[model samples]
Target: MKTQTLNVGLVGYGMAGRTFHAPLIQAAPGLELTTVVSRDAERVRADLPDVEVLSRAPALFARPDIDLVVIATPNDTHFPLAKAALGAGKHVVVDKPFSITLSEARLLKSLADEGERLLSVFHNRRWDSDFLTLEALLQAGTLGRVVALESRFDRFRPEVTDRWREHHRPGGGIWYDLGPHLLDQARALFGMPKAILLELATSREGAEVDDDFLALLEYEGLRVTLQASSLVAAPTPRFAVHGTRGSYVKYGLDPQEAWLKAGRTPAPGWGEDPLPGCLTLRDGGEPELVSREHAGLPGDYPVYYAGIAEALLHGTPPPVSVDEALEVMTLLEAGLDSYRQGRWMKLKESNGLRKRLHAH
Candidate 1:
């Protein structure tokens, strides 16, 4: 097959845009980071020297040569920017949380369908080393029939900055920021949960929005707990999974984000995680630590853009499908509702109109 190069227009220059999207998109086989829509021309030029920097998103959308528009802007701006991009007949990839609301995500999906453009979410954590390892263990039945899973994205940021993420807005919160990754990973591992119970708190002294959250996703015979906090000095197991046969406990996060922050390009050993997860087996109703050096599967963020390129050029499926992202959005909204009502929110009927709308 002839490789087709797709021109990508990135719509932000913030931490996410500069750190994750730009480098991954550039590293992808058939995608080119051609244009960036940011007010900081000097900063964009400094990182992406040959890329065109546009002051406005509309101008970038109007360009006939741009094949894909990746929205890495603030969470609230995701809906409008993606709507415009899809309307302009460009394939769109939005950063996590899909949108501020389920309605916005559904509308974007509708527009993408009408425009016949491929739409996907950047759930890059799906490719994380720890996650990949757990997924493999589950598939291999190493941990037979996982009954409980705990995932944490804890950090030690005691002070909340004045960024949009920390402001009291629709999309500003740790839940929206990190919840998508955790929720998506859970769903990927155990499919959709029957219900969700969420507890949110503004723990930091100066925090305007929620800086801590603990969500409980209930399955048939499984219980998944997802937690994130801005205050934590000690290390917590990134993933702790237990089942009938054994348990797998892992500490330390995947190294890709840190690597990207250090301005390192993806290459050999890019996603290799040095910290191995400890696996324990049940020995005649007694637990025995078998191996603490179980090698984690390598993480690969570049696979996301590479999948996008193949989807756009050769008719392959996207890395994260639109339907899967809509499911994540449903859980996000349910989490908020659960917190407000102080009860568990059921997801059985949540996919009503949106699922029908996407059926076509």
Candidate 2:
């Protein structure tokens, strides 16, 4: 008998779905792009004419054909949607920042456990070309010991849009929006930081939310600076890592976002690095900047969905496990606390609940 394919149900048709999840879902094999729940049925149908577009999530959840549900809704609705999907015995994929708080993340984990459903998050930035290159460099130890690492995600949106992001509300700021990506990438490279120093502000006039954030992470001898701003005109170094032996500097954003926004999915040279990174070294007395092409990795966002399918079908672990997401939430809460209290927050003791999850 032929094995059954995983049927997917996407809960939103906004930028997250239109740009990231939908195209990737259709690209991956062993998965069926089944249904999408959107209020504007005409818009959703226009994009995915072949797929079934529903008006509400209940319609999608009620269908036995859907084996997995991907939640790409607002930051506030993540928990409720994930919980309801898991409760209905459907594996789920949540977008980044998982939920508004660490408690909600834990609650969803419990619900998934009780319902025996697989839960994962779409931390797709992990597969960026430059990040993959940096990961390889660090693992190879060509830089000896990494001393300081800097990662920045900046834009020149000085004027705040009418979107919910510019409004001062829960999970409506640069820290919550872009913080997860930076923090998760850091956790992937350098475990959790011992502590973090945050510099957060709202630069855009009449903006009710924070549009700028800079976090300094401290590890015994290694220090990492993560910065994101919405009002920068000049682009700074995308990535800069300094070590005892050499330094690597990469300038340019990954091409995945651009390609995805253009309705292009993962194909040959999909997430290729556009700009050649520079490698500088001081051997004897002089320093040299060596131009090198980073071997780009495929941006496999569909892998997260595929992993969820496999986990539910065979009782395996999801790609972005609940524990890993909790770690990120823990870091986020700590960063916010540090920002609010104006003092360094030790990540180790900040979220006891999250630490327990980490222990497992």
Candidate 3:
């Protein structure tokens, strides 16, 4: 057992805080769910009976016992909460879509640097079973030199809810909601794209912001297209990769999120995906394409918090580095520019958005 524990104060007890952050922090070794900042103390207490629940973020931040502050609130509030957390001398973790804008993201980075505190964004999909399998395949040259890849995160919610995500506000859209996962996954696989083109739409009635989107990331020899929709009635392959050697198509989202939402903690078979991805490859001696099912490695969302604990307790680098988080933000902002300009937005050579945006 580890000798140290990082007491985490989660700033929101809303959907994200309750569904994702609280549970993950509780499960992480060397981390304690010390306090939660929420408007609904009853709800928080119903779930985490032992943990303290503060009525406001400032109250939580004032507590000297909190070693880490996790901002899992609404998208727009991420910046202020995280900034305050860092100012309070706490290691920080912000849920995805780090902030609404790249400038905000940079400011947060500067704060973390000045404070010498660990700061990371939660890009949990990196540990998805299918994505993990895909990464292994690419590393093993299973899909030799991938030329084109399509990643889709689709849902069938046609009705617009009154939630902050669906309302008209800065950072209130599907692009910010789901784009980070796809962008981070693409960056993980193919570094920075040479250029990017994005299209967004508000297709549903009563929708205030974009609910459907298609973004194309152009690489030197590869093209990665990321798509998400609110009205996707039929099923779509979650990922389809075409390469020089063969193609691998995987359907179904990683089961971890669903499992977590269903209130199941990590255990044996926790992250297993029932649907195996299929690989189509040319035979050794023939022109025929051989198809086979590829078993995916188990998904491991718990590893993210574990890594955070290790980084704080043992001085290892964070699993989701600030640079990586910035890269995702860079594309996110660039994608918006592409949508606005109706043209491809060019990116810097490498280390996507590590430098300031003036270079791009």
Top candidate when judged by TM-score against the true structure = 3
lDDT of each: 0.90, 0.82, 0.90
- Give a tens-digit lDDT track for model 2, residues 188-279: 88777788888899898889988999999887677799999998889688899898877888887887788788777677666666686777
lDDT of 2 at 107: 97
Kindly report which residue pairs in candidate 2 clash with one another. none
How many clashes does each candidate structure show, in the order listed?
0, 0, 0
Deviation of model 1 at 16, angstroms: 0.6
Off by over 4 Å in 2: 283-302, 313-316, 349-360
Clashing pairs in 3: none
Clashing pairs in 1: none
Give me candidate 3's TM-score against the actual structure: 0.96
Candidate 1 global lDDT: 0.90
Query: Considering TM-score, where higher is better, how would the candidates rank from best to worst?
Result: 3, 1, 2
Q: Which ranges of candidate 1 are over 4 A from the true structure?
A: 1-3, 283-291, 349-360
Which stretches of model 3 miss by more than 4 angstroms?
A: 1-3, 351-360
